[model samples]
Target chain A: MKAIVHVQLKPGVLDPQGQAIAGALASLGYDEVTGARQGKVIELELSGTDHALARERVEAMCGQLLANMVIEQFSVEILD
Target chain B: MRVAVIVFPGSNCDRDVAEAIAQVTGKPPIMVWHRETTFFDVDLVILPGGFAYGDYLRPGAMAARSSVMRHVLDHAKAGGLVLGICNGFQVLTEIGLLPGALLPNAGMKFICKPVKLKVTRTSTPFTGSFTKGQYLDIPVAHHDGNYFAQKDELSRLEDNEQVVFRYENNPNGSINDIAGLSNVSGNVLGMMPHPERAMVHGKTRGDGYKLFNTLMETIR
Candidate 1:
């Protein structure tokens, strides 16, 4: 089984790299972009066969390690 | 003081910190690897700065879950002094040993320079030798040193006097200009500055010697 975890800074948190990207886009004449917030994606390949169990484990992993609960939020999706 | 400097997979400042401790306390600190679960006879524990675990999955996030951190958490709970510098501060926050989180600098730049830090409180083990509100010149180098906390938590930290150091000038957009903080018990401190690095040049009145000297006196 495989699971994909998307981790992102929560709303209202300042995204510095995102702001820098927005500025560079404006410099290149692509001024329509208002903002860009960066995050990360992690794909985990597991040996478990049970989808429900894998999802549960992945959610636990998000709280434990993948996402810093204080600053970032996470969403999980099971791969088909 | 018997100090122990914890070395993660990519910790580069462990030796510098050990040397600083040796210079001040006259005894070298024990360098404990990340795999070791036990630290022997350590009165103070330091998580030195570096790209621990190559800054994977965010700075300090991976190292917070490493094998030895379990022991570190226990040590902090036992009221042992724990100091986290730069990346170590990031790890302390990631592990929930300290409140708030460090993010990329607002300018999106990796800052490496000497900054002024005012000692907010002198009661803590790390700052007891320095006068309250006295400024210290310490070097800070990191990509993610901007500290953030919830509004209410900020007030709580203020009300409880947990803030140990505040930046003389806000360099990285840390909320409330917080440069360093102590836990409620005052045994653990997490800061963005590198006191060890600043120990070399002693011309500035704000140099980091008094901080280490104070800790040595208190522990001994």
Candidate 2:
């Protein structure tokens, strides 16, 4: 089984990299881009056939280490 | 003072902090590797600055889960003093020893310079030497030093006077200009400034020296 986690800064949190990227895009003549937010995507491979158990485990991983609950939130997707 | 400086793989400031502690305490600190499960007999445990684990996932994320942190957590639980500086501050936040998260600098820059800070409260274990509202000029070098906490938590920190230091110039856009924080019990401290880097008298303001000197006095 494969698990994918998407971690993103919570709403109202400032993302300087995303802001810089938006600025660079505007400088490159992309006027419609109002803003951008940056985040991380982590992929994991687990030796489990049960999707439910894999998701539960991956969410635990996100809570424990992958996503910082104070600043970021995460969503886990399981692929079999 | 019996001190232990935990050394993670990429920790570059462990020696500097150890040296500073030795100068103030009249004895060298024990350098504990990250893999050590026990902290042994020590009055203080220090997490110094550096890109621990190459900052692979997040700053301090990997190092916070290392073997030694369990012991550090236990030490803090038992009312032992723990000081986290720079990336060490990041580790404390990661391990939930302290509240809030240190976001990247608002300018998205790796800021390295001498900045001024104001002492918020002097009753904590870390800021006893400074007078109330005293200003300090210390060197802060880090990319992620902007502190963030939710509204209620921020108010809680303020109400309890858990905030020890606030930036004078708001260099990194930290909310409420918070530069250092103490836990509720005031036994643990996490700050972004490199107090160990400002120990010289003539060349630098040496305000950082006062922090160590005062800590020794308080512990004694």
Number of the predicted model whose TM-score against the real structure is largest: 2
- lDDT per residue, candidate 2, B1-220, as tens digits? 8999999999999999988988778899999999997557888999999999998788999999999999999999999999999999999999999999999999888999999899988988778878988988888999999999988889988999999999999989999999999999888999999999888868754888899888888888
State every prediction's TM-score relative to the real structure.
0.96, 0.97
Q: Which prediction has the highest DockQ against the true structure?
A: 2
The most accurate candidate by lDDT is 2
Q: Which 10-residue window of candidate 2 chain A scores lowest in summed lDDT?
A: A48-57
Deviation (Å) of B114 in candidate 2: 1.0
Candidate 1 on A24-78: residue-level lDDT in tens?
9989999799899889899999886888989999999999888988889999999
Docking class of 1: high
The candidates' DockQ values read 0.85, 0.90
lDDT of 1 by residue, B1-220 (tens): 8888999999999999898899898889999988896656688999999999999889998899888888889889999999999999998999989999998898888999999999997788888878888888898998898999878888998888999999999899999899999999899999999999877565643367667888888888
Candidate 1, superposed: residue stretches over 4 Å from native: B200-206
**Model 1: DockQ vs. true structure:** 0.85
Q: Each candidate: RMSD to true structure?
A: 1.5, 1.2
